[model samples]
Target: MKGLLVFFFIFILIGPIVADVPVREEQFIYSIMAFNGRDYSRTFCGENSDTIYLIADQDNFITTSKTLVYYWPITGDWKTDTRSLNYSFEGTLELTEKRRESRIIYPERYTFYNVKGEYEQNWKVAMGDEADKAWQHYQGLIDEYWQATYQYEQAKMAFDLMVDELAMKITEMRNDGIDVTGLVEKLKRLGPPESPKPPDDYIVPPMPVQSAFILNLPRGEYNICFINEDSAVMESSEKRVVVFEKRRADGIGFEVIPGDKWTRPVESKRSSSVLYVNGTTDLYLRPFFQDEYNDLYYQRMIRNDAKGNPSLMNWVYIQQVPGGRIEVTKNNHTSAILVEEPFYVEQTKGSALGYKIVPFDPEGAHKDRDPSLIAFKIPITRETSLIKFELLDNSGLNMAGSSRQVRVIIKSRWQPILLVLCLLPLLVMTVVRMIRSRKYSL
Candidate 1:
């Protein structure tokens, strides 16, 4: 009876606490995403007056739509915009001045290519401004293929029926004790019709037309407003536009890939930044051409945020480049021009399994596989602590943008001994206590 009363009291006290949790409500907002050559880049709008930046001489698409947004407390990030409610707001994007208009390219046939040494896709536009004609031509080809397929199917059905009928007649004649040896020989020679091959290199036509706006303007401020059907400017549809140029275009940057952690690559943007590493380690370096721009203007251009620091500058990676050799100088004297080499990671055998990295040999072990990276192996010795790197072009000229330093910190060999010494006092105290307790009990 007492246990029951306590259980009822506990349940009554906890019920209201669980029921008071609040549920998130769905809210609608505008969404804008643009395709920047490779993939779609989303521009999140935090407020109505945020500015949106876009690169000049590129393709950009803009659409205004309503979407559901909810805050998830677990992740602390906004949930994906679901249920696209495209509210019809008939308007025209009005710019202050006439920007460079994009050329309407009607690619009849296009081929995709991987950009050399860069993470971008290059599309080769072929036969421009005849999209309708190309669509009609491809439609005609599809119809012809369909007709051929249909005719082949009908002919195959008819052949199968005739073969079945002949076999039935032969069976009937055989039951009647009539000679059908010559007919059987002819039937053996007549096999089923072969399937027709599809048309060679048939490529489906792409989009009928592609339109883009080229934003090639000088460094200045601009405004873009949407004029509604009533010819009135939409208050929330107005967005600020800033056109800025790169500060410097001839800077070289590096994507530093550590041997221990390759996925978490660090960028060496400026020439004076020092890369610190502990003990002997292998480093894979990928050089890139970078440009500097204002942080506020650049960030606002990429995302629609009301708060941005206009005073700071940031480096933007343009593309990766080759034909450069890296020179590693240790302690300002011992230096070596490091060339690109292949490496292989071999897994260890037995109970204590591990991985061992060695110089890759294409003709021997790694014949079937390609080298993971074209890297320079730097063995950090204990005596040589400070190291600096200089990038040189193929003609043996120093690359001003690729100069950086590496500082090595020697690992302490007495760390294990120190840890043991610290734990010895505790172990001795524990043993003494045990000994004292035994002596007292006795």
Candidate 2:
């Protein structure tokens, strides 16, 4: 039967490539993390998991190893724990309120910034008291830019070996004919040897590790325990931490983005939701500083995930709220306010190409670029509106959970009469099958 239908289409295409292999196993977990104020975030723990979350005055890090753990059929979750089957356990975490946490050793800074046409970068850590004098002046400008890039690569390898021995002594003095024309105009004015200019904001920082465990405590519910290396108490390393605090600390939270989808940002966070949009283009909001919680106590304080949901409620975010102004309004009587601008996208020059955006002047046409989003441009007109927003602060006040609402829509000119009533039932079933094939061929 045609080779059994090509062996049943090669066993249904190798049965999903042999059910995508990966099953793994080995256990013992707790590798905790938690320093969010810009860093350490992880917190996984499954062996009949238990609470963990931190952030009540930052700094955290736990240990307990023995690895492997697989499964992950594409985020149906759980893979990536095999740190070469770790097995480390030699700790000292012990909290239960006897606080006293400190072990500082610092030096891992990184916070770049300059992204107008995308791909910027970020790492940040330098907090307070001028983070050790800006990490010793950024590690003395990264050791003087790596000793001026090793003396500019040994003066560009001795000026490319003296320009290849002056072009082989001007080609043996022009094959002895002698008219070198001033040694080929001194080898065309001895060119090529520039390079050495890197130190403008050099980075390379992070090194001085002893890895974290600095607690700073304050907001309650602890338990921790680890202590091994003989003082026993290790076994599954004990957990239950919690710490939280932020259920409502100057709310707000936006992020939005959308200049035709700048990497899908969208997160408004309740003033009773309603963000519909699509009145044409340009958006970019941002905002931040949030809080809320409870989704099973913030997913068991970040992870130990038995699927969360303790009467739902989430939020979190926290920072970015610089200067503000927003306002917007519209149907509740016009308004406007706005503020942080600088746009510039441009692009269309022919054949229906598109992108325009505009407004970015710095001192005239993006003088040194970098501005793409400290935004609030939102100009989507067509009609079906609503709008609304608010924010303020910078002495103007208002910013608590910064109002919301968007709705826009617009699209109807009788909406193409529902595409001609969906092509009128496929044009009346092809004119009643052409009048029943000419009335059954007469």
Candidate 3:
């Protein structure tokens, strides 16, 4: 009976694995071009979601797309197949607040590109005519690049033929015992044709059909739905819109990546966090200013669902500090100023997970090695007890609200256990002496 029960359990577990199952389902999803407190990004709401969230007082974008939606059981998340099966809906969006206020919105054109100076803080968004112009400019750059590439290819072929002919002549001169020093020098001076360069990938291509309804509303709850040509409201396209704002704004935070554990970087959401480590550590600190928001509301704004605690506050990173150095104060007096520089993380053996973080020197053999991180390096030692770090501008003034302290608690390994074991004989002797005294007195 026990054997039969075990067999039944095995059969039940393998039944799904042995059978063919369709994990994907067709559904109309509301794709969004959302403003995530800093910049506009793409996110979606599938059949599993009934509400759409956004940061209040910002231009949020949304559109309707019919695509194949699937449940990814591994991550327990819903994914969409938009490339092969995306069918865009043609309709205007209607937003009604409290059933008293109503607004109809048409699709708007928008594009974004990373600007050169102050990159983190300057992701410029072009809208309408500006969007069209920027896209056309990018297209023109593409055409010019192709033309240049073709010309270079033709010139390179001729250059290669000339190089080969010159090589043959030089060989003949050498064989005939003639002085070919000048000819060799001339050949050495000849170089290959320069390759044509492509445009920056950060200038996003514009999509006309991917039009979205931009909503820039103050804090409130609103009901939004798609309006078709037949003057009918799309029930499947309906969603509850929640426009929220940040609680605490512009607080500096750091993503502390330790040398030993590269993958498991510790996030100091606030500038200050206690670091409990062993002996010594080197940290790669990427600092940014951010705002605190409701955990649930912020997640709901960026993704399909609010997957965190509603009561807790979540820090949303906005941008890196402009022209600042990291001042690390050891024991609150002795200090070291760490400037932001490129550093490379060199991996030793394959799968051994050994990494050495070194300063990037472009002139030496390390020139070919691309930098893995651009951050302020903070070195901690056993002698240093407390650490306080703050951001400072070029004028040597402290950035307000950018100060934080880290209390380092070094951990000892097996010391307490060894001490107890060493004192066992002393404890035994004390007990024996007490027993002997009591026996003699009795």
Top-TM-score candidate index: 3
By lDDT, the best candidate is 3
What are the runs in model 3 whose C-alpha is more than 4 Å off? 1-16, 19-23, 83-85, 200-209, 349-353, 411-442
Instruction: State the lDDT of candidate 2 residue by residue for 186-268, as single tens digits.
Output: 88898766676755553335333334345556677777766666767666656677786666655787888777766578788
Q: Which is superior by lDDT, 1 or 3?
A: 3
> What is the alpha-carbon lDDT for the whole of candidate 1?
0.64
Clashing pairs in 3: none
Candidate 3 per-residue lDDT over residues 118-170, each given as its tens digit: 54545656678887887787778788999999999999998999999999999
Cα lDDT of model 1 by residue, 387-422, tens digit? 888888889889986889888887788789989999
Model 2: runs farther than 4 Å from truth? 1-33, 41-59, 62-91, 95-145, 148-150, 153-205, 211-222, 225-240, 243-267, 270-272, 275-283, 286-312, 318-364, 372-377, 380-384, 387-442
Worst 10 residues of 3 by lDDT: 201-210
> Model 1: runs farther than 4 Å from truth?
1-40, 46-49, 56-59, 71-84, 87-90, 97-216, 305-308, 345-357, 410-442
lDDT of each: 0.64, 0.68, 0.80
lDDT of 1 at 298: 66
Candidate 1 differs from the real structure by a C-alpha RMSD in angstroms, to one decimal, of 12.9
Clashing pairs in 2: 66-87, 252-401
Candidate 2 CA-lDDT value: 0.68
